[model samples]
Target: MPLALYMLGLAVFAQGTSEFMLSGLVPDIAADLQVSLPVAGTLTSVFALGMVVGAPLTAVVGLRWCRRRALLSFLAAFVLAHVVGAITTSFGVLLATRAVGALANAGFLAVGLATAAGMVEANAKGRATSVLLGGVTLACVAGVPAGALLGQLLGWRSAFWAVALVSVPAFHAILRWVPATTSAATGRGAGPSGAGASGASGASGARAGDFRARRELRALRRPRLLVLLALGALVNGATFCTFTYLAPLVTGPAGLAEAWVPVVLALFGIGSFAGVTIAGRLSDARPMRLLVPGGLALLVGWLLFPAVVDHAIAVFALVLVQGALSFAVGSTLIARVLYEAVEAPSLGGAFATAAFNVGAAVGPSLGGAAIGAGLGHRAPLSVSALLVAAAFGTAGLALAVRRVRARRGEPAGRTLTS
Candidate 1:
């Protein structure tokens, strides 16, 4: 992989740390702001809500300008939001900052994925995406735990300050390594010079308004593609359903001290990193194979979570397992979508990010409501199991439809994979 690809991953790491570190900071934020835990949890949902709205808007903006300019604008806004966030005392102001920061975050991720895809060989697209998205996995492992520890030692606001500071290096990496002229705007595989690039002709041809419109409409009409998107949502929803309240889940029921929270989160993050690494290879070679088994594993982990919560060793083990299983699905889902919607690169990339955030927003909101209804922390685990089960069913349906079409001697839609 190019240094530029690694730079994209680093940029995502900066954004993801800012987004996910909140999982650990929720309790501290609630205590500091004098709000209930459930209310503070809304911060996660608020950010996801911003992503839901911002991704498509960013996609449109990406289509209108040079890719580097759009990416830089988003990063600048992200840095600005965290700077303000580090100082805000009012919870309302904090919520507003999260929403604004998420808007920028969404833009970066959507454009970043498309850019990564554009940067690689056609056969190497899956690996490039995995490298880019791995930044988020690394953030979960290193950034989130570090932020939690920072919040624990200094204050929750200090975590925001740290996020802002690290973003500086990411900005410089993009400016130095990420070339200005050649990117998705020119076509996939086109580099800074824009010549001798494979796939450049197809990408340029996709710029035709009528051709792009037809491609998008055709993608929308494919129920298999839409089902795959729903699978993405459900997979993420299942992960976040338990993850949103993971701190409390471990501390309250698993009998861990508050100090151990970051350690456990770090363990989960490590598992996520390993999972994504393994899944990346499978995604390029066997996406459907990984997708089905990965979803099933997550469902089983969640269903068994309640039984293991009371045992500290078992709870810790389960946390690692669940995190790995959930994340192992990420590369597969991204690769699958890119394969299915090969024509509309921007829209496909935007949908992948937006769909995941939609689930992110839903999971936390539902977890909060369950907690408010006096269901306690473990309820979220059950919720996660149900969501994963739904994903399994949806995947089954998609497979069945594809098989039916093949049996009838009809095309099983435009599959870029076997």
Candidate 2:
């Protein structure tokens, strides 16, 4: 992978902690700000909501700026939000900062995806994406738990302060490594050039910009791309249903002690890290090789999860396998979205980001609804199975349609480039 990718990944590690760290800080935040725990928990949801809105909005707005400028501006805003959040006494201000920080984080992720892909060869896009997205898993594995520890030892405010401070090196790495020609106006595989490389001028440039914007917007309407986005969402939602209520499920039905929760969580993260690492190397070469079997196995795994939910050993084995399979399939779907959106590279990143955020919101809602209905821990597992089945139907439909298109002698992977 390119140095730029590592920088972007590092940047994500810095910002991504803010997303999950709040799960551990809710009690502290609620007590300190004198808000209810439910209200404090809403901060995390607010961030997801902001990302869903911000991804595409920021992509369109950032199209004219060079990558460094756009990424740095977003990063600076994110750090500043943390600074304010750390010092603020009001719950309302903390909520607002979470939203602002999420918006910035969304922009950074969207840009980072596009940049990572553009920095590599066509055949290496999968690896590039994996390298960049690997930071997210690492954040889950190390950053979140570490933040929880920080909040436990000092205060919740310390976690916010730590996130901002950690970004300082990422800031420097990006400044030194990212190229100047990395903007929407520039095509893929450009080397570092003069700062003015993306500087367009006059009526012709304006017309071209308008045309590009229209193309990006139109990319969203493609049938195949839309299906892939939906597939991404369903698969992600399935995983979240399992992930969101993991601790309760462990203790409630699996009969695990409270101490075993973190062990199980860490195992899942480690499995996910392995999945992303291996899948990235191979997804670009033969996506279906991983996707078809991986998807099917995941579908089967979820179907079997409920039966095994009560057995501690079974749950452990199931969680480990599901984590690996989920991320394998999920990463492939992510890469596929970018592959199909060849016409709108920048917009493709935003689309992928928004799709996953949509899943993040949907999965939690479904799981929450199941629990509210008195479905117990097993309810989430059942919903997860249903979600996986929906994902299979989604992929099968996409494949069937593409096969039909192929029979008609149309090209593949274009989706909407025409």
Candidate 3:
């Protein structure tokens, strides 16, 4: 992998930390802002909504600039938003900052994935994307917990300040290490080298950005691809539905002390880190292997959460397992989307980001509604289980379709399973 790939991962870590830390700070934010808990939960939904809206919005605008330039521009805006968020006293202002920052975040990720995929050999795209996404999982491992601790000690606003400060170094890293040519913006592959295949590598490089934005949009309408997008939404929605309220869940039904919340979160982070890394290594050759088991694990974990909430040890262990299961197949899902839209890698990447945030928005909103309805803290997990089961059904339908095509001797676009 290129140094740019690692740097992209670092960039993801910085932005992702800012995104995930809000979960732990929801209670503090509610108290400090004099808002109700359900209202504070909307912060997560708002950020996700920004991501869904910002991805294509930025993709169209960013097409004029190279990937490196666009990434830097987005990061600058993201950092600025955090700075504003850190200082803002009004909840409305704070929410506006999250929306603006999410726009930047979505754009950066979409461009960054396209750039990373272009920077490597054809066979290495999966690993490159995994490394990039690993940064997000790593944020879970270190950044989120530390931010939660900072919020616990200093205040929720201090966490935003820390995010702002940490992002500065990432900005420098991208400017220094990521090259200017690392974009598919002008229908030219930009990177250190082309994808390894000789004949199929397009005029400039990979089969990236060859299609116009309109064609890319059209390609995304494929039935299987739509199912994949829905799958991404469901997977992420299930994860966040429970995750956004994790602090309270642990403190209440899980019977853990408030002091132990961060520790448990750290454990969840560790599981996520391992799951992403492992899933990444398998993504290129055995995506279904990861997806099937990972989805099943998610279903099982969510189902178990409601039953085991009163058992402290059981809940702690479940949190770790659930975290791992939630994120383990992420790279596989991303790889599937890229494969499904190989002709329009950047748009494909943008769609992947959008699908995720769509779920991000849906999950928290439903969870918050459940909480608002006077359902117990455990309601989120039940909601999560139903969502995961739906995702699993979608995946099953996809597999069944693949089998039907195989029987008819029709070509399956890209082979996900051997």
What are the Cα lDDT values of the candidates?
A: 0.78, 0.83, 0.80
Residue-wise C-alpha lDDT for candidate 1, range 312-342, written one tens digit per residue: 9888898898888888886678777776666
- Residues 119-215, candidate 2, lDDT per residue (tens digit)? 7887777888888778877787888899999999999999999999987777887788776566663456444532344555566445555666687
Better model by TM-score: candidate 1 vs candidate 3: 1
**What is candidate 1's TM-score against the reference?**
0.86
Give a tens-digit lDDT track for model 3, residues 1-418. Answer: 7776787788789889988888779999999989999999788778877899898778755655556677889989998999999888889999999999999999989888877777777666678788888888889889987898899899999999888787777676778866666444432354343222112233533333333566678888877788888998998898888877888998888877888877787788888777777777887777887888778878888998899799988877888888877777666788788767777777888999999888888998899899999998999999999998998788788878888998999976555553
Instruction: Report how far residue 417 has shifted in candidate 3, in Å.
Output: 3.5
**Model 1: per-residue Cα lDDT at residue 141:** 84
Which segments of candidate 3 are over 4 A away from where they belong? Answer: 24-42, 88-92, 152-155, 185-211, 371-375, 401-412
Which stretches in model 2 have alpha-carbon errors above 4 Å?
189-197, 201-210, 402-418
Instruction: Give candidate 1 misplaced runs (Cα > 4 Å).
Output: 24-42, 87-93, 183-186, 189-221, 370-376, 407-409, 414-416
TM-score, cand. 2 vs. native = 0.93
Give lDDT: candidate 3, residue 236: 87
lDDT of 3: 0.80
Error of 1 at 44 (Å): 3.2
